[model samples]
Target: MTYKSDSHIRNPEDFGKVVVIYGGNSNEREISLESGQSVLSSLKKSGIDAFGWDPNQESIKYILNQDIDRAFIALHGANGEDGRIQGLLDFLNIPFTGSGMFSSAIAMSKVLSKKIFLEHNLPTPKFKVIRTLKDLKKATDIFGFPIVLKPNSEGSSLGMSKISKLNELEDAYKAATEFDDVLLAEEFIQGKEITVTILKNKTLPTIRVKTNRTFYDYFAKYKSNKTEYICPGTSDISEEKIYADIALEAFEALHCRGWGRVDFMCEKNSIPKILEINTVPGMTKKSLVPMSAQCKGINFETLCWTILETSF
Candidate 1:
């Protein structure tokens, strides 16, 4: 990915001593480690004073003692992206990148986010919360076969399954429930998978994802080489604007800030439905945010710098 030259860079000393927070005890620790390391290296390459700190292996006091001015959060899932760490940082009076506490909390919950989307008439897929066997039965009655089952708060597509029949529902539900007490059974929309990247309150570019696997599961997202990402997904400028508008609306509806990504499933006839919002998107080599950003003339290093600038 290549980026055109621009004037977005700031003085290195403006960042002070920065800590790239990643690799928590969350299920996404490995991916967080990769993203955090990538971010740390990028910040250093950009001439910023940056260091990596893993909350799982280090104490908060150690980080506080480092005299860090701000944090570039790369942690994913659970205590990381779900507002726990955001609250901690707020209490510490340190500015960090990405959404604030409440927005992060809402974005982390699939059920709550979808509920807000539905209430606001945002174009999200129909869903039902599955907690008991009776709730599962209700969901089957509502969505029937070919539904999606996944945990409410996990990221990186973890604990997600597509159910095609009644016989498969129980196993899929079991798999999802093992990850979170709150699971969601959603109507399956067969279409092209796409995502919109938001940076500094501006929509960067749209990415259309095509995967050979069952769906954009964990493997297809991070590990599989077969997955392809296409930027500027549509040929028509108006259609792209429509998708961008909806993505921006969804981001604002959740009160998101700094930077993030909104995913969509474009159904037949080019109708886009909001899937979910990613508050702290992956920065790994295979991550989509950078792919989308690159299409907008923002290289990985420049992207990290731009995101870090949000701390102010």
Candidate 2:
């Protein structure tokens, strides 16, 4: 499938002093820094007056005094992807790239995203919200072995674990709860790990991720060099379209605007189950969105410019 470049903005002057917000207090701070730097470099290369802002090192209120016209969010995890910054941007009447407050908050939480997906009759892995050890035990009993435990509001698969036995349950739960009070114990779907990138409400292409590690954890996402990405993940056009169609539906169901990425787990001869939506996906070198976008001939600088167009 061919994807037309969405780069409609011809002048960097149109952006008028853009700030790439990233490196917050979230555990994904390091990754966000990398993403922010990459985006900052691209935006500058495209001749945009872009700057990097790390809320962790400086006060967020300083942004208001900087006369910044808009923001290109590179932050991940809490305070970033969870809508706090989006709310601030909305309150300040400053347009930013990616989804608004409500959608960002909903998309950041795996529990909430799953609820919305189920309500829309979208296929998603069965999950139980766990607040206590008893709740974890109950979920384990229901889902049996080989279940997945993850923090509800974290991203980049941090504090996420796939348990293959009962002995690993306590450790997984302990690890996940460190990130968020609420946890999601989900039924692990053994299948192809697929992701779809959506830009300006259009699905770019599907990507299949292969990793030697136990699932796509934080290490596999950023550190592992062995990870392989397959663009247009499916072999047939019909299958690819099916994935793309469902991905767009899922994005709309979450009320997500601008750009985002929809994740899925697809088993052979079965429907793909939606995992979650990423409102502000990574812009790092190893990120999936850029890889999928590149497959459609959208270079990094042009992609950054196109995403900045979403701010308008």
Candidate 3:
């Protein structure tokens, strides 16, 4: 099931008409547009009959009329990644890349994903759900200073904040709640940030993220040129195996299929703590998944074609 290339697909015509869905009315629309463009260009370069569709500019009904055989989801956040579009495509009987509706719904909610991870005995940071000032107070008492506050359901670190004192709690909560009514307060694991990319149930080389900023925020993810990415995240083979194993376990536990990315925070000599699962990760030039694939000798076009095969 390891999709290293398009070896199984002898001809691009077999793919039929493909639609790269992206740019929904989500806060991550800009990122999604870039990702969708990248994927669409790659598909065309590979001779696949591909077209880009932006939900914000058009309607879902229009896609049905266009005779799109399958979809390559490049959208992120809200309607795109929260299972709404997946469900719609399922009802229309069109296969799409990435997880099913149920899995997508669960993974979109950080709170729900954490519950599944804990149920499987997976290592994840301690967290508390916050809906009010009182809930934030309770969480601060448990996690103390330098706690991470983020929207319960968001991506690209859109509404995430790290607070180190009581005075910063309200501002952080307000910021996160701007994206989602519910928020998550997690224990800030002081360690290296690494991400694992999974394609067709196979793990790609891990990438360790380094940034001079306080943490890898939206700026560092897509905008910052100073950010450094170290492939094979850890030098030790055993440690790399640990990250890959945990990533696969987490992906399966959530019933996520196709391609995805699992992020982690690893403290020295400590087990890596799961951050969150990205069902439809970014596909822009600066994306981490492509970076990991490149380390394994899989070019971006090949990677895009392999992901499209998942719809089959």
Candidate 4:
């Protein structure tokens, strides 16, 4: 169902006690804290009896032991997004925002998700798995120079690098492996970067990301002010529809539900290549999902309310 502001529950009391999950023991803990606070504030402002829950401080058993009727997962990376917490919630029989355990695990792994993308005939960057120097050598030989190296399971552009030469491979691989055991060396698609946010099985406006950095790294995504975002990605209505359609298809391909974001790299006249899917995307002020929602006339409170409704 397409989620509009007016279609959501008007009374926040109906939501019961909600938990905004975030701040786990991950590389993205800081960001998760920010996202969780942002979501908690929005939910509270909307009158939804919501509070922040950091898994690092309190265990999942503690949370399940609470009176939480549903959860709004704002956590990113590692144990938080890797289906561990989702499984706990599933066992507790507590509804939560975003995809379930299976989909969460698949979406968190870059290697597995890319395989699904290819199997489903979805356009994604050509990629090769990297676990050793020998694998890196083979990837360099096949993909040539200017390949993107990133952890198999990471977010917020953490441990991602654009290797322009063979000498940089080892360093890039080392950085990525610090975050995940498996690394992915993908063909760098030189084009405009765009992201599409999906809510309630419907696509929101697309945002074209422009960064002065070599690529949209962790700094460019959250720290850099040089980044620019252009909404309604294309001037042509047909092109916009194409982007939205592809985004919706990609989101569904992974069985991603509730709400999520699909990132793409597109060149003129070429099909947009799916980069990855974010099941529990950020809710910070600089986040793409909230930015896209505002473009569609959905305020932060309404967006949070609509997302919480998905837990039902």
Separate clash counts for every candidate: 0, 0, 0, 0
lDDT, residue 70, model 3: 83
Error of model 1, residue 260, in angstroms: 0.1
Q: Could you report the Cα RMSD, in angstroms, for every candidate shown? A: 3.8, 3.3, 2.3, 2.4
Least well predicted 10-residue stretch by lDDT in candidate 1: 1-10
What lDDT does candidate 2 reach at residue 100? 86
Q: How much is 42 displaced in model 4, in angstroms?
A: 0.9
User: lDDT of each prediction vs. the true structure?
Assistant: 0.87, 0.89, 0.92, 0.87
Q: How does each model score on TM-score? A: 0.96, 0.96, 0.97, 0.96
- How accurate locally is residue 270 in candidate 3, as Cα lDDT from 0 to 100? 95
What local lDDT does model 3 show for residue 59? 79
Cα lDDT tens digits for candidate 3, 1-312: 122222357689988898999998999999999999999999999999999899899876679789878889999999988899999888887878999899999999999999999999999999999999789989989879889999999999988999998998888888898999999999999999999999989899999999999899999998899999999889888989999999999999999998999999999889999999999999999999999999999999999988998873
Report model 4's TM-score to 2 decimal places. 0.96
Give model 3's TM-score versus the native structure.
Answer: 0.97
lDDT of 4 by residue, 1-312 (tens): 223322467688978889999999899999999999989999999888988889899866777668978888988998778898889888877788888899999999999999999998999999999989789879989999888888889998888999998888888888888888889989989899989899998999999999999998889889989999998777778888888898888788888888999999987789989999999998999999999999999999899889888873
Candidate 2: lDDT of 102? Answer: 92
Any residue pairs clashing in model 2, and if so which? none
Please write out the lDDT profile of model 1 over residues 27-63, one tens digit for every residue. Answer: 9999999999999999999899999999999999879
